[model samples]
Target: MTFKSLLGGAALSFALALPVLAEENPAIEQRQGQFKLYVHNFGVMGGMAQGRMEYDADMAQTAADNLFHLTRHDQSRLWPEGTDSMSVDGTRASPAIWDDLDDFVTKFAALQDAAEGLQAVAGDGLDAMRAGFGPVGQACQACHESYRDEAS
Candidate 1:
């Protein structure tokens, strides 16, 4: 195969591998892994916004883009039934997540929207990023308050 064909095959393989569903216990771990990625990227933006980290437009844009991608990622398998904190150890997902999945998904969609907004403005300037920051944080807080168990 040509070099470009090889690279295309690899990319296609990766894309096809992304959607396999996990079993219940493994689903918890999968979702946790996904959340860790979200936290890591979001923390970069948060640090910049709070002045805890120096603002770099390229880094901010990359982080915002990663967060946007993550927020839009399909994680239905990662949230399989019986994966909540009450059923699974080492998780902070409340059973309420399953009880009212539609509302939970609505809240997630709101976060996705907020992340898109951040992605659009994150590299514009500190002022622009700061303006976009609050909505993302609020969306996260709203979902966590309703769906996630408090950290011990």
Candidate 2:
């Protein structure tokens, strides 16, 4: 092939690879930010649920309900149809998530269950509410240990 044609082909190939090469996309950034926000809210709600800080029953229940709703919504959107080659802050979500999709789904489903249970029990009373909070905290830690950035 002519040198000019070869150069043109090479340029085209490079351009095609640009998206992957950048390792950053606005959509990914936005999603990552949303996930971080979810984590923060979860932590805050969990703290209240655990009685780490003083919080009224109504406030605790509201937080728990919000956390449960957001977690389910975010998980559905983030894991849609299985994804690979998506990482935020160096979290290489293990391939098992897609390979063993059923297992991942089960684990996340358990998390949802815990979150919902926490919400249901949140306004019951402080001691009973704290009892319910344990599982929800465990669920977050379980997913994070497996799927998220440990450093973060």
Candidate 3:
């Protein structure tokens, strides 16, 4: 091939790679926002279950069940290969999570365990539900402290 043709082909290949490179940095805002929503719902249900708020056994149980589902949802989508930090619009997720992936995975699994524990006792009564709240809350706080933004 002529030098000019080879050079043009190489340039075209590089341009084509840009989109793939961009995809490597997936947006994390949606994931973070979902987590925030989950936290809000969790608080609402937990409050009711603890009698800190008006009790509605049905609503509280539904919320607890949803929380368990959210915890079990695939979380890896939030972090892409070779990605350490993700910026979606203005929200920031620290790269420390990818750097310490094992720790991140462990915390996530712990959170799931806690959520499941809460779910298992959700139908028994408020006292039974309250028994699992502390560990679950701690799991969330631990992961947020390590991976999420401070404001989060």
Candidate 4:
């Protein structure tokens, strides 16, 4: 029932679920690939935040670093104009993304800031990790709530 044990299991599960073959759209393939990574790291950090797993400073810091780096990359190429969920069969990208790209980019900026903030404090201690985790989680929620479809 420890977090490390659960994280190991979750990592195995996520590893199996990772897609290897290309999707119909290259953008979808790449986007989903990137998101799978995000999900895995975020899951580890979340486990620590929730006390669902024992906190390992190394693991927490590693996950925070991964998330922070991932957000730093330019993902603009992954979201083409016509690839919204309404048009694509394999993605949850909402049409709203194309409608207001500025807001979407701003949300990603928030995520980058939050992830960077978490990276700074994750290895400090349980209390620091717990404290810094909030904004990152909230940033993710904000973007998902606005630009991702729940239908997937």
Candidate 5:
């Protein structure tokens, strides 16, 4: 392999190993994993919406349900205090989250509401998917704008 590729591989390996190497908090890892799960399901619906992937009814419904399902969990354990971006090495959770958790939860409730709407129309058609996904996307953006790191 070329030197650039070799170096790139090493960099990737190091990035993937960052939590273990840094001895970071487990709550950070858990919450990050939960967000990754959100991305995985949301990416599927987003791909269909963007025409990057062929729209399939079953996949759309499943992805929408899974995304909404994530919203139903308690999620308290994943967000322990001292795990904000200011205090943690690898987290992107903003300090603002702890500043007013009730408001933060209200934002999350908006996501839940929007995701439920998306799940309702997920299998209807691409146009419906587009319409439904817009609110869900907006909900996520609203929360991220307030409580997520730009780099995250």
Candidate 6:
């Protein structure tokens, strides 16, 4: 029932659902790959924040670091125009992503800020991690709400 164990179970279940091969469209494949990493790392932080897992500084730091690393990467190539769900069969990306590029960029900026804050506090202690978790989760929610379709 500990947080780490619970997250481990969830992660295993999710791993079983990951795509086995790259999509024919590189954009969909790349975005899905990015999302898989995001889901895995975010799940770790979320499990600790929700008290489903024990707070381990090392584990928290590692998870935060993974998220932080993602924010630093250039993901422009993953979201080309015409790659949305409306046009593609394998993706759930909203067309609004390209239509509202500025907002998406802003949300990503917010994610970057949150990731930096989480990275700074992740290894400090539970209180620090708790304090930093909200902004990152919120940033993710903002982007998902605007650009991602709910899973079927």
Candidate number achieving the greatest lDDT relative to the actual structure: 4
Q: What is candidate 5's lDDT per residue for 1-152, written digit by digit as tens?
A: 99999999999999766543113667677777788899999999999999999999899999999998998988998888777877666677899999989999999999999999999999999999889999999999999999998664
Candidate number achieving the greatest TM-score relative to the actual structure: 4
Error of 1 at 40 (Å): 0.6
Clashes of 1: 0
Off by over 4 Å in 4: 1-22
Range of the 10 consecutive residues with the lowest summed lDDT in candidate 6? 15-24
User: Total clashes, candidate 3?
Assistant: 1
Separate clash counts for every candidate: 0, 0, 1, 2, 0, 3
In candidate 4, where is summed lDDT lowest over 10 consecutive residues?
A: 15-24
**C-alpha lDDT of all candidate models, in order:** 0.86, 0.67, 0.73, 0.89, 0.87, 0.87
lDDT string, candidate 2, 28-117, tens digits: 445566567667766666676656877678877777787778667744555533234443333345545766778777778888899889
Local error of candidate 2 at 89, Å? 5.9
True-structure lDDT of candidate 3: 0.73
Regarding TM-score, does 2 or 6 come out ahead?
Answer: 6
* Deviation of model 3 at 68, angstroms: 0.7
Checking candidate 4 for backbone clashes, the offending pairs are 3-53, 3-54
Per-candidate Cα RMSD to the true structure, in Å, reads 11.6, 4.2, 4.6, 15.1, 10.6, 15.1
TM-score of each: 0.82, 0.69, 0.72, 0.83, 0.82, 0.82
Q: How accurate locally is residue 140 in candidate 3, as Cα lDDT from 0 to 100?
A: 87
How would you encode candidate 1's per-residue C-alpha lDDT over 84-130 as one tens digit per residue?
77665667889999999999999999999999999999999988988
Is candidate 1 or 4 superior in lDDT?
A: 4
lDDT at residue 45 of model 5 (Cα atoms): 91
lDDT of 6 by residue, 51-118 (tens): 99999999999999999998888999988877777666678888898998999999999999999999
C-alpha positional error of residue 125 in candidate 3 after TM-score superposition, expressed in Å? 1.7
Candidate 3 residues 101-144, lDDT tens each? Answer: 89989998999999999878766677776776677888988998
Evaluate model 1: give its TM-score: 0.82
Candidate 4 accuracy as TM-score: 0.83
